[model samples]
Target: MDPVDSSAKSTPGSNGSNSASSLPGVASPPERSNSQSNKPSHIAAHRQSFAENQRYPPPSPHAHRHPSFTQQAIQDLLINPPSNRHANTRYAGRDWRDMALSELVPDEAKWADLDTSVEEATMTLLKNNTSNVVLIRKTSDSKTAISTFDPSDLNAYLLVVVGLAKPNEEHVAAYDEISKKAQSQTPISLREIQTLSRKEQLVVLPADSTLDGAIEAFGSGIHRILVTNQSREVTGVLNQLRLLEFFWNEAANFPVIDRLYGSLLRDLQIGTQQIIAINADAPLADALSLMSNEGLTSVAVVDHGLNVVGNISTADVRHLTNTTSLPLLKSSCMHFISVILSERGVERGRDSFPVFYVNPYSTLAHTVAKLVATNSHRMWVVESASPSPSAPATPLLQASHPVPTPAAAAAVGATSPPAPTILIPPTTSTSGPQSPLPGQSIAVVPSAALPGSRISGRLTGVVSLTDILNLFAKSSGLNPSDPSEQRARRRRSSSSSVRPTIEGGRTSVDIRR
Candidate 1:
């Protein structure tokens, strides 16, 4: 496969060579800093907590038994949902239903111009502590974005450029020495980045749209909706995580859904047991390639012994933009993880790499809390297994040759929009796994299990933000499984797609080196 051609040829649908100098409302880019000490202390704290395996104790069984009137009112609102105009009326007429999405804009939201460099955008994400940077055109009056550039996009770019640039070279030699020489700094613009990105149109909701409308959008399988003001200028982004975080923080006010928080994941049938893992000893490039080809955001990192030691995410790919971190792509996933931790200040006393995992018995509320606290998108579901030491470690799927990462390969077709027509899959639907894993299905060597304990058992499954938000959608009468009721409740959104279609059994290809 050819390396990504970053020449000035215009990508389809992009405005040609628009300069970013005069874009209104575009924030000045932060100064480039290579100093490790300049990184945010809070980010370090969050990563440190994750590295330590901070687990939340489940709420007391009686925690929701007796609720205040306001709590009951909120619960009643959810259980017996009020009409669109009155959605928030039950909670003492707070008018949340009438409230505009503008009010929910996060303070740290970041934006970029199409002319912004990939390296600059990468720095913006790290310095601002944000996941995505909305890319807008320089000449447009309205802050309409062409696409959102994220860490995953950066990862896809680098993998194509560095990892797969020389396919004929030995894997060890190609990966180990590619970054050692002085590399040319190509100023790849955000416009080109969008051309190569997953072609999902931005889902925009007018800022004046009601909270209830926003809820419905999320329920309809739209992972994120851009909140644009009256001028059609992008102001904020609303996603499943922020919405769920709001619910969690205000649990006291919403009694109906609050009671469900204490239910164990197993009881609720929440999360999918289908998981994808990579050997810690494998090259980091292999993990990146695995995620790229599979359309995954994260993958669990396990040791040769089949014990999940930690996790490596496409988000971690952002760190590679720096000179100090890029060379590690050729290194083992385990070593790359260590450098990542050291940069985050978690290497102070930690020897073992940490992973975000939960047992099947963990409560929904606790899992949500950890996700919010750590700003993580997914958690592994593991169960204790005392595999005989002699039992060979779980085997990896093998391939005899090299496969191109998304960046190096020909443009794949755009994924379909979320379908508003189908019933949401039951939380435990047996849709075949999306990516490769150790053996068929998660190796669920179920031994004695403890709910909140930190045992690195065999990987069973994963729970994600999408899973939890879908539950909320179900409660709000959006994703009823019954065909009759589903038809009645079906309200199509321009941006919705069924989750199962995305994860439906694609053959798993091994990307391990």
Candidate 2:
């Protein structure tokens, strides 16, 4: 005070005009006069305001906002070569799973103050390119955090939202009731369901089966194949789409196959060779998430030693969804028993199996005939059980059965008498858990608690399209059997929370999942 250091003493009351904001002992700019009469007053005022701001630090642009990035599977997210942030503690020590929810609602905001942004919401779903996101509807109880993204695979995720309506008791009761209902009353193997519906086939040709033979197999009856050696061990699944993609890209050398035939060979890359093969003992959700992420029809089921066993496909999952059965007799039945005119077989009767099982390693055209001959939806895709989870699945049927001409099964289906229709009783007849068992010990991460030790194969975690459809029926208060249920459910569940968005300029407050 006695002899002021002009740089430090300019502001007597302000302590340390000197920290990082200003260098230690450095003075802030001179204050401006309030007089309006001076010609230079306005400019001085502007400079003073700017200087005042310079003296104090400003808030971060991202302080109130969460930074979002387009990410692949959280494991693949580039943690930082250019930056040093550890993957384990990127955002408040939260893993990618927790980071996803934190972005939707930060902790600082009281429950009511959190108004989720459309921009942030869209970005939150960047990782899930395949599964639908059901938004969390705003409610009196904002404490309900969003359900986590359950992994379907490297490509899929599954979330169940209360679609089309806000939550209510009746909704809970419906799910409770249906879930408790009988799931499997018939001897309906997963195969029967696919056979009864339109069957999808992936083929596997012999290793000696030429590229030309493989191409001929394409578009015939199968969409995929397991290329195997003479002794019948799977080398790789020859994808029709990959061959077609090769043919399409190198069309000059490709033979003039049917354009219709060539199209199936074009690799849309829908299913890649690095198929996410899970241990048969792994969680059902593991298979579910994998297929969901990949958007594939099937997954090769394997054992601990990496040997292929069977494939639990989308067709199997479809069976899980459409468990409710109505009478399915399509044979010319009402007339065959009427006043005996003459016992004549109808053009297309139903008793003889149209398709039978084929080994996954054979030509697909032949597999299709197996599907018809055995009345199967899909053939058994099996490989010998080995000691690891990565082994190729061998189609057991392919190794043992004969792949007859398609005409063999076609002609038989036309001659047999239709079997009598079976009526499915109301769901209350059977007993099961109110919800499909959420897997246990199939830890969110690997269960390496005892590496090289064995685990059982009881984990089943996929939620069927039927499960999705059923959730929709409840929120909308629609009857348990509505067809639009599945469509509406799929649409509403595409977002993370069940909260509705303004669509077609109309706001529908009702939430039906």
Candidate 3:
């Protein structure tokens, strides 16, 4: 898009009637009324002179001064530089919106193999600074051949898994089982390692497509989408983080402030189905299960009343793995909440956790400001009057009070606290797609009362980086759908085929022409 022109100029004959006023049947401005004739002649002449002066202001009497040599050089360097002209693309001149997903995603060859062991995959993720791994398996289906398929009849079907972060109960158990077999001199099979990895459906788009399509795909609940070449071979993958980086780094190009101002959270399309939450009293295993199963980065923890008390995120899981044993995954969610709250110096009162929330009626500008101040990926939207009056009005963070480090905890004689006991009401049952283990119980909490035991506000929804991109797409007029003509062509060229399941316990990939 071209830069907007700001210089103002007057049209020809704008001060009086011209061709437009002379048009047939065009009415002219009304003449002064007879009552106005009572006004003094000097007063009318003064008014006409004032109007003319206002339209053609007098120029400044001061002479224009030439800039100093240094100032002139600086100005020349900035406006018409003799050097670094090629560096234009290195800065704001480049538009990320026009860039394709393939340009941003890493090469497919760097991805982990489907049969890679848990330990190896974890190491790869840490070394590469990536949380996900593209899992691929060899296939011999001639009908699904691509240009890059190996001549030896070996092609691969791809699935993705969240490979970083702490290992879940199932992953730990699988590792232990495999380790035991290996220690006993028994061989481990590729299938065993693959079974431990939780698979997610891979969304695919063409490599030539713009970022607008990527925003729409992510807004549709996809965590990442694999970019493919014209021959149907995987090229790269675009995830939420990369998309967010593009949005934030190119924020100046977007009119988010103007478009989102005064808009409510509900206008962003948030709903219960999009919320990934766990009961406060539930086990850490349950939270891990939810994250792994859904490929989520965080899960909200709520109380028996369904009020949001805190959040357990992948960062928290990483901290746990670095500081504690893997078995701690079996601990209750309340224990994790306490650890986080205590570390943050949040006192137990009407609200058990130090959660940041905004009202549903809050303006988008307010939300964006809070997001920038907190440096948070997402924030909870709650109803007004959620926190009880008895709850202490502690700020989100105190500058004077330092968070306790490991050494500080030891210096203060603080040790790992025991897990909190929860009394589960019989009426409460397991929530989400995962089922609770036998002998385990869960408390049922209403949506309005889930965050805390106190009379807190209900969790309406959440807003994230993806929502921001959606707003940008709308404001920039980048419609996220194929043209009607292209859609008809695609529909005519499309073929319906069911691809075989790449892995034993994984979902089958649905291939389309």
- Over 4 Å off in model 3, which ranges? 1-97, 102-110, 128-198, 205-208, 228-236, 256-258, 266-276, 290-297, 319-327, 338-356, 365-378, 385-457, 464-513
All candidates in order of TM-score, best leading:
1, 3, 2
Predicted candidate 1 versus true structure: per-residue lDDT over 359-459, tens digit per residue: 77777877877788767878887767535243334322221122322221212233432211101111232242221111111111111121222337666
Model 3 gets an lDDT of 0.45
For all predictions, the C-alpha RMSD in Å is 25.9, 30.3, 18.8
Q: Which candidate, 1 or 2, has the higher TM-score?
A: 1
**Which has the greatest lDDT?**
1
**Candidate 2 on 1-513: residue-level lDDT in tens?**
322233333233444453322433333334445563465756756655666676754433223322233345342343211213222223333222112221221122112112332112322333332222212224524433222111111112111110111223534554333223323232221111111111233344455544534433432323344444565543344443344333323323322311222121112111112223454445444454444433445444544443343344442321112111111011111111110111111113311110112222333223333333322223433223333323322222122222222322333455542332212212232232211111110111111211221222211222122222232223223344442332233222224333333244232211111
Which pairs of residues have clashing backbones in candidate 1?
75-256, 418-496, 418-497, 419-496, 419-497
lDDT of each: 0.54, 0.29, 0.45
- Pairing residues by index, what is the TM-score of model 2? 0.21
Could you tell me every candidate's TM-score relative to the true structure?
0.59, 0.21, 0.47
